[model samples]
Target: MDEVEVVVAHSERATLRVGDVFLKVDGDRARAGVEARAMALAPVPTPEVLWHRPPVLAIAALPGRALAQLGRPSTASPAAWAAAGAAIRTLHDAPLPPWPGRSADDLAAALDVECAWLVADGVLPRDLVARNRRIAEAALRPWTPVFVHGDLQPSHVFVEGERVTGVIDWSEAARGDALFDLALLTLGHREHLGDVLAGYGTGPDLDRDVIRGWWVLRSLLTVRWLAEHGFDPAAPGCEIDVLRARL
Candidate 1:
């Protein structure tokens, strides 16, 4: 019997790889439904959905490895990064999904609550958190929502040579700010930002400040989550470094 390799196991979801198939077991059946629906609607490359049975969905593994992983330097060429950018652009150009994403006011309210917790818990320096909080607020302004991957982490992007072979994890897919996806692709991978932008053909319409703001917001929001999940966001070249760059 082939070993069932655990790809990721968290409280909300778990992924197991057996042979060429990945079985995603989500705690929330609704989330699994969203992922399946998003994959069906996405025009860009995505893993083939083999089958679905309630909380577990089976998908065929993509041909190539992930573009990059968190807390590690990407060996992929600039061209590969650019290809990812192009893939993201294609996704953003698609028609918006039926469901809406979080609103600006909701995000602002959540950020305020999270910031207060960080300060009270002393998870980060109050001044540092305050500065990043201020910067993050720039993203809370109005934006014309478009189709977004929701979670566009480097590890979710599969690349073969200079081409983006596939993208995975679509539960968060929804209509949201386009810059959010751009910021996610470049987060913690600042060196590759220029290359990605080149492929994306980011223009004057692109809000660079908002993109930067999302970076800070994402990092701040995820630190506690990562810590609780047995991952360290404060490690060198990780989320903390991204936040520190603002200083």
Candidate 2:
């Protein structure tokens, strides 16, 4: 029998790997349903859904390794990073999903709440949080909705050589800002932003400041959640460092 390997485990969800299959156990069955639906709708490659029952969805593993991991330098080549960007562009260009994403007001409110908690709890320095909050303001504006993977983290993207194989983790999938996906993809891997933009083909139209804002916003919003979920957001090159970089 193949030994079960825990890929990720948190209060909201957990993923376990048994041989070539991944079983995602989510507390919210609706999110699982959305993940499966998003994977089906995504034009890019996604893991084949073997079966889905409430709380547990089984999927076959993809062909290649993750594009990168947070807090670790990526070993993927520039071309591979570009490939990821291309894949993301394709997804964004797809037809919008049925559901809506968080609005600017909602995001701003959440940011306000999180920032106050961070300061009141002494989780991070007020100056650091304040500066990043200022930077994050740029992203809390109206955007043309696109078919976003929502949580397009580097680790969700998989590649083989210079080719993108598949992107995983679609629970956060929704119609949102295209830059949010781009920002998340290059969060800790800023060195690859040029390569990604090259493939995304945004040329002079890309708003780099907005992307920068998202980096700060995403980091700030996720830090406490990460800590609560048993993740070290303060690790080098991770969420805290990303926020600190804005300082």
- Measured by lDDT, the strongest candidate is 2
Q: Give the per-residue lDDT of model 2 (tens digit) for 45-70.
A: 99999999988999999998999999
Query: Distance from true position, residue 84, model 2, in Å?
Result: 0.5
Please report how far candidate 1 places residue 15 from its true position, in Å. Answer: 0.6
**TM-scores of the models, in the order given:** 0.97, 0.98
The residue pairs that clash in candidate 2, if any, are: none
Residue 200 deviation, candidate 2, in Å?
0.6
Off by over 4 Å in 2: 203-205
Estimate the TM-score for candidate 1.
0.97
Off by over 4 Å in 1: none
Tell me the whole-model lDDT of each prediction, alpha carbons only.
0.90, 0.93
| Range of the 10 consecutive residues with the lowest summed lDDT in candidate 2 | 197-206
